[model samples]
Target chain A: MQFWPWYLGGVALTTVAVGHWLLMNRMMAVSGRVTALVNRVRFGPDKAPALSGKELEDALLAATLAAFGDEALKAPPTAPEPAPEPAPSARPQLTLTKPQGPGMHALFFFGLAIGGLLSVLLAGGLEVSPSLRGARFEALFDGPGRYAVLLLGGLCVGFGTRMTGGCTSGHGLCGVSRFQPASLLATAAFFGTGIVTSFAVALLLA
Target chain B: MADPPCPHMKSCEMYEIFTFSETLAVWKTRYCQSDYSRCERYQRALKGQPVPVNLLPNGHLLEK
Candidate 1:
C-alpha cells in the first residue's frame, strides 16, 4: 500500500507537538482542548465574563500603564474627541449574562477537519475501505445497527479519554515526548488494550 | 456593592450579579458541547452578530 513512511510521520507529528507548545504554551491534546470548548459552550453568557475577557483587558491596561507611566492612560492631544454617547434605549442590547457558546476552540476543531481534508489532498487522494471480513461484518450489523455500534464506540472512547485525562495524541505523542510518568503508563495501557482487543476479536471471528 | 463599569468588570466573580439559574445556564453552555447548537451565543454568531469576549474561550485570537 502507498503510504507515508512511519519515520516521516513521526517527525511531522513531533514538529506539530513542539510547535503547539512553543506557540500556545499548551499541550497539544485534542481531547482536552475539545473538552474545554465543550465546557465553555455548556456554560451560558453569565459565565462568559469570567472566562478572561475583561480580566485580559484590565491586565493589558495595567501593563501599559506600568510600562509607560500614567501618561499611557491619557488621550493624546492630537487624538479625536470620543463620539457623543447615544441614548441608552437607542443602543443595541446584548445578553451579556448568557453563555457565549464555543470560543476559539471552535476554530481549532474546524481546523482539525480542514487539516484532514488537506492531508487527503496532499496524499494524492485516500482510498478508504473496511478491514477484515468487511462485507460479512456489514451484512451482520447493517443500517441502524452499524450506526448504533459506531455511536457506542464513540461514547466509550470519549468516556475512556475523560477518565484517563488524556487520549492517544495527548498521552502517546505529547505526554510520552515529555517523559511524563502518567503518560507513559497510559500509553502502555493503550497499547496493551489494543493488543488484547485485537486478539479477542480474532478469537471471536475464528 | 454597586456593579463596576462594564469595561472594568473582570473575573468570573462578576457572575455573582446574575441569578443562580442564569449563572448555571452560562456554565452549562460553556462546559457542555451538546447544548452548543441551541446556545444563544452560537446562534448569534450564525447570524453574523458580534459576540463578546466572555463567550469565547481563551486561545488564539484568529482575527484579533
Candidate 2:
C-alpha cells in the first residue's frame, strides 16, 4: 500500500489548527488537554467558584454573547480572527473564556487516536503484530521490556511537556505561526533534544 | 521567557480601568496580561473597525 504524502498530514494539521483558533479562540495545544485531564483528576476544576453542567453552558453562552454582541447570540461567527494590535491609544482587555474541562480534552484525545486509526484503516495498513514495530525498538527492548520502555518514555514526555508549558503541537505549530519568541525558543529546544536523544538511543541500542 | 504583556497596555483605556479599578482586575488577568489575541477591542482594532471608548473587553457596553 502506498503511504500518504507527508504534506497531506501537514495540510490536515493546518486545517485542525486554524479551525481550532477560528472556532474556539483558543490555542490548539494537545498536551494542554492532557494537563487539563490530569489536573481535573488530581485537583478539581481550575477555576474557583466552579460552574458545572447547565451553569457551565450558560457561562459559555454569556461569554459568547459578550464576544459577539446581542445579535451574535443568535448566530455566532464562524471564522474568528485574531484581534489586532491597538493603534496609538487603546488597551487590552478580555472576557474570561475558560478552557474546556477534562471531558472535552478526553474527547479531543480520543478524536486524535481514532483519526489516526481511521487514516491507517483507509490506507489498508491495519495489521496486528506482537513484537514492537521497528527493528530498532525490538533490538532496544525485546518482548515485554518494550512496554516498560514505552511507559517510561511516556512519563518523561509528560513531565517535559508540563515543565515547558507546551508540547510540539503547541509550540511548534501555533506559537511558531504566531511568531511568539518563547514558542520559537521552545520549538528549537524540543527539536534539539529530540535529535540528540534519537542519536544517543541508536548508539546505545547498536 | 514569560509571555509578553499586551503592547497596547500603556495607552489603553481598559488598562487604566483594569489597573485602578480593583473589581475589573480579572480582565487584566485574562487578556491584558497573557493573551490579548481574544480581546474584543484588540480584534476590532485589528480588523480596522471602530472601537468605542466605553467598550469593555467582553464586548459589553460599560455604563457610566
Candidate 3:
C-alpha cells in the first residue's frame, strides 16, 4: 500500500519483535526455539545456546527498528540503560522474556480481536477513502461474512501465536530486526505453512 | 591457545571500567530474567543451544 502510516506502523512493529533477540545473542527463531535460549539464560548453558556480535546486532536492529517507532531511528542514544549483571556461569545464550510468556503475547491477541470486531460491525457500511476505507466505524461489516471470518481469524491468530511462540508481530516483526537466524527461519516457516494452509482452506471452502 | 580471561571478567572493579560494557550486556541478559534479555552475549554464551531440527541452508534448501 502507498499509505505512509501503514508502512511506518509496520516498521515500528518490527523493531519491537527483533530488538530483544539482537540483545539476547540468539537467532530470532519464531519456531518455538526461543524457549531453548531462555532456559540457558535463566537456568544454565546446559539449557540453551549463545549468539555472536553480528547476530546480536541483527536481533536488536530487527526488534528495535520495528518496535522502536520513528523515534528510535532518530534518537537511539536517549535511553542509556545501566550495564546488566553478568551471568553466574558462562553458557551460550538465546531468547528473551519480552516476546515469550509476557503481556506482549496477550496484547497481540487483543489487537486481533478488536480488528475482527471492527470488521464485523462495519461489514456493509461504506467507503470513505482507499486508505481509510477500513477505518470507518460502520464499514466494519462491508465484506461478506467478514465478522464471522474476523472472529475466526482472531482465534487462528491466537493459536498461531501460541504455537509459533510468537506471532508475526512477535517473530516476523520484532524477531527479524535483531537478525535472529531462528526468527528468520521461523518467519519463513510460518509463511510457508500459512501459504499451504491457505491453499488447502481455499479449495475446501471454495 | 590459552588466554587469560578478558580482564573485564576478573574483578567487579575492573569489570566496571571496561570499554565493553555494551558487549557484555548482550551476553549477560540472554540468560537473565524479568528485565535483561537484550544481551545477545549472555544468550548465546550462557543460555543458548543448537536447534533440534536443522532449519539452516543444509537442512531445507541445500539438502541432498
Candidate 4:
C-alpha cells in the first residue's frame, strides 16, 4: 500500500508542533506582563494599562492555559484578579498556574500516550487500516514483528508527542499554520527523531 | 491548595483555571488532512488548547 498517509501525517504533525511552540512565546510574555495585566484590572485602568475586553479574555486564557507544561504558573499568583460573578472562583488560578514538577507535565504526555496506544491498536493490531500496511515498513518485519514494530512505533509517537508538547494534530496542523517558532522547533525535533528511530528499527529488523 | 484526589478517581486535574496570562497570546491551529470531512471534528476538538492536525502537502490553510 502507499505509505503516503503516514508520510503526510509525519510532515503535518511536525509543522504543527513547530508552530505552536512559537505561539506560546507570543501568548505568554514574561510573567511580569501577567502581573501588569492583573494589576491594571484589579487596581483600576488609571493605575496601569487598561484591560480591553479582548485583552481580558486573552489574559484569562493565558492564565487558564494548562496545555504545554509551563512551570511558572505552578505557584499561585501573588495578586489574582477577582473572577466575574458568572465565572467560578478557581477560574483564574487553574489556567495560569503551571505544573511545577515533571510529574505534572506527565499528564499531558500520558494523555497523548493513551491516544497513541489507542490509534496503534485500532489500526495496527486490529488491522483496521484505511489502506494496507506499506511494504517499506512491512518488509522489515514478518507477521509478529510487524505488529510489534507498529505498536512500538505508535508508542514512540505518543512519547515523542508528549516530550515536545502537542501531537501531530496539535503542532503539525494547528501550529505550523500559525507561524509559531516553538512549533517550528518542535516539528524539526519530531521529524529528526522519527526518521532516526524508524531507521534504527528498520536496520535492526533487517 | 489544589483539590485532593478522590478515592474512585485517579489524581486528575479537573478542567479548571489556576492563574492568568499577562499577555494576549493567541494560538491558532491549522489542520491539513485528506479528509475534509473531519475538519469540523478537529475544529471542535481544538477548543483552546493545541491538538493534532493533519495537513496536506501544500494546502495553505494558515497564515498570519
Candidate 5:
C-alpha cells in the first residue's frame, strides 16, 4: 500500500483552513466549535429565549402589513371601532446571526473518522498480530491493567483539550498556521508535557 | 410601522440597545440543529469542490 506524501496532506489541510476562513468567516478550530455546541446543550433554552408565541404572531402580522404597502394601511375599517396595536413587550426580539452550527462540527469530526477508516482499508486491512513487542510498560502490566491506563489517558486528553480550548488539530494545524501567539504557546506546552510524561513513564517502569 | 432592526446588523453602535446575552442567544439557536447536508456549500465540500463566497449563511448554512 502506498501513502501520500506528508507535504500533500499539509497542502490539503492548509487549503481547507483557508477556505473555512474565506467562506465561513470563521477560524477552523474543531475543538472550539465542538465546545460551543456542548455549551449550548449544557445550558438550556432559558439561557437564550426563543421568540414567544405572541411575539412571533406580531412579527408575522407586521411583515404581512409591510408587504401589502399603502393599500393595506389605507383600507377603511369595516367595524365601528379600530383594533388597538399590540403591546411593545409582544414585539419580536432581534438577535445576531450565527456563522455556523454544531451540526457542521459534528460532520467535520465524522469526516475525520471516515478518512482514517479509508486510510486503514487502503493500507490492506488491520494487522491482527501484536504490534507492541518488547515495550517496557507492556511487560509491567497485564491486558486489563493496560486498558485501565488507556482509559485514564483518554479521560486526561478529553479534559485537557477542554481546559486548553483546543487539541492538536485546533492549535497545531489551524492556530499555528495563522500565527496566533496563544496557539504557539499551547503547542509548545503540549510537546513539553508529552516529553516529560514519556520520561516519567520510562523511569517508573524501569 | 418601522421594521425592527436586525440583530445581526453590522453596526456596533446599537450594542447599547441590545445586551450581549440577547445577541448570543440568537446565535446559539441559529445553527444548533440545522441540517448542513442540505446546504449547497456543504454539498460542494462533500464532493471536494470549491465553495463560493456568497453561499447562504456561511456559518449556519441555513437559508433564512
Candidate 6:
C-alpha cells in the first residue's frame, strides 16, 4: 500500500487552506462549498448584486454615512474603549447587498474530486473494486451491508458538518492554524469523538 | 438603555481587526454597535451558515 507521507499531506493541506485565502480572500471550507452547491441546486441562482469591487465599497461608504452621519468615520477615537453596549432604538433601516453565487464553490467541490482522482492516478493505477478496501471495514461490514453503513456514516458526517458549520478542512486546518477558539474547541471535539468511536469499533469487532 | 453588543462580537474576527484600524471604524459604528442585524456576518450567523473569519460587515471577504 503506497500512502503519501504525513508531511506531504500536511503541506498539501496547508497550501489548500492558505492558498485559498491568499488567492480568493475567503476561508477554504470544503463543507461550505458542498453546502453552497446544495443551496445552488435548492434555491436556484442567487440574486446577483448590481455593484461589486469599487462600486460596492462606494455604496457601503454612502450607506454608512447615511446611517451613522458624517461623524461616523471620525468618531472612532472618541468612542469608548472595549465597545459600549449599543442603544437599541432608532437604527437606520439599511442593508448592504453583496454578490453571492455558488458557481465558484461548485467548481471547487468538483475540483476536489478531480484532485483526488489525479492523486490516485499519479500514485498508482486506479482499480475498480467493489469490495470495502479496509480490513476493519471488511470484518465489520462485509457484504452489501457495507454500502448501507457507508451511506449512514456519510449522512452523519454531513449532518454534523451542517450542525457545526465546518469540518476538518475548515475548522481543523484553517481555524486551528489561525488559533481560533471555536476551531480549537471543535477540533478537540472532533478528535476526541473520533478516538472514542474508533476504540469502540475496535472493541466491538474484537 | 444600552442593548447588548452584536451577539457574535466577542468571537468575531472583524471586531478584533476593527479594534486596531482607525479607518475601519465605520464598521464597528454602523453594524457592531446597534445595527448589527444589517451585518452580513450577523445575518449568516443567524442563518446557521459558516461565517468565515475574513467575512466583512458588507458580506465581502477581506482582501489582502
Provide the RMSD of all predictions against the true structure, rounded to 1 decimal.
15.3, 12.6, 17.8, 20.2, 15.5, 7.9
Q: Give the runs in model 4 whose Cα sits over 4 Å from its true position.
A: A1-139, A196-206, B1-64
TM-score of chain B of each: 0.34, 0.84, 0.20, 0.17, 0.36, 0.84
Q: Which of candidates 2 and 3 is the stronger one according to DockQ?
A: 2
i-RMSD of model 4 (Å, 1 decimal) = 16.4
TM-score of candidate 4 versus the correct structure, residues matched by position: 0.31
Model 3 lDDT per residue over A8-121, tens place = 566644564556457653344333443544554665444122333445445444443344345434422423765465774643343221223334434545655675456445
lDDT, residue A204, model 1: 78
Residue by residue across A36-89, what tens digits does model 2's lDDT show? Answer: 676577656654333334453355445434654555423223323534546534
Residue A35's lDDT in candidate 1: 65
Cα displacement (Å) at residue A132, model 2 = 6.1
| Full-model lDDT for every candidate | 0.56, 0.68, 0.43, 0.41, 0.54, 0.71
lDDT by residue (A1-206, candidate 6, tens digit) is: 36678999999988888899898877888887777667667666655444434554455455556556767567665566545444546322222234346667667878898998888788786665545576877866666888788788889988888888789998899889889888899899989998999889878877
Please, what is the TM-score per model?
0.52, 0.59, 0.30, 0.31, 0.51, 0.70
lDDT of 6 by residue, B1-64 (tens): 7656797886675586556434457778768987898899899877865565446787765332
Residue A14 miss distance in model 4 (angstroms):
15
lDDT, candidate 4, B8-27, per-residue tens: 11111211111133221111
TM-score of the second chain in candidate 2: 0.84
Better of 3 and 4 by lDDT: 3
Question: After aligning candidate 2 to the native by TM-score, how far in Å is the CA of B26 from where it should be?
Answer: 12
Of 2 and 5, the candidate ahead on lDDT is 2
Interface RMSDs of the predictions, in order, are 13.9, 15.6, 12.1, 16.4, 14.6, 8.2
Listed per model, the TM-scores of chain A against the true chain A are 0.64, 0.70, 0.35, 0.36, 0.62, 0.76
Q: Predict model 2's lDDT versus the native.
A: 0.68
User: Which of the numbered candidates is closest to the native, going by highest lDDT?
Assistant: 6
Off by over 4 Å in 5: A1-9, A45-99, A127-134, A203-206, B1-64
Residue lDDT tens for model 5, A1-206: 45667987888788878887897766777777666666557642222223334453344334334444444344333323444545778654543333355677788888878876787687677444332344886787677777787778879988888776688878888778778676798999988999998889888877
Clashing pairs in 5: A99-B59, A99-B60, A100-B59
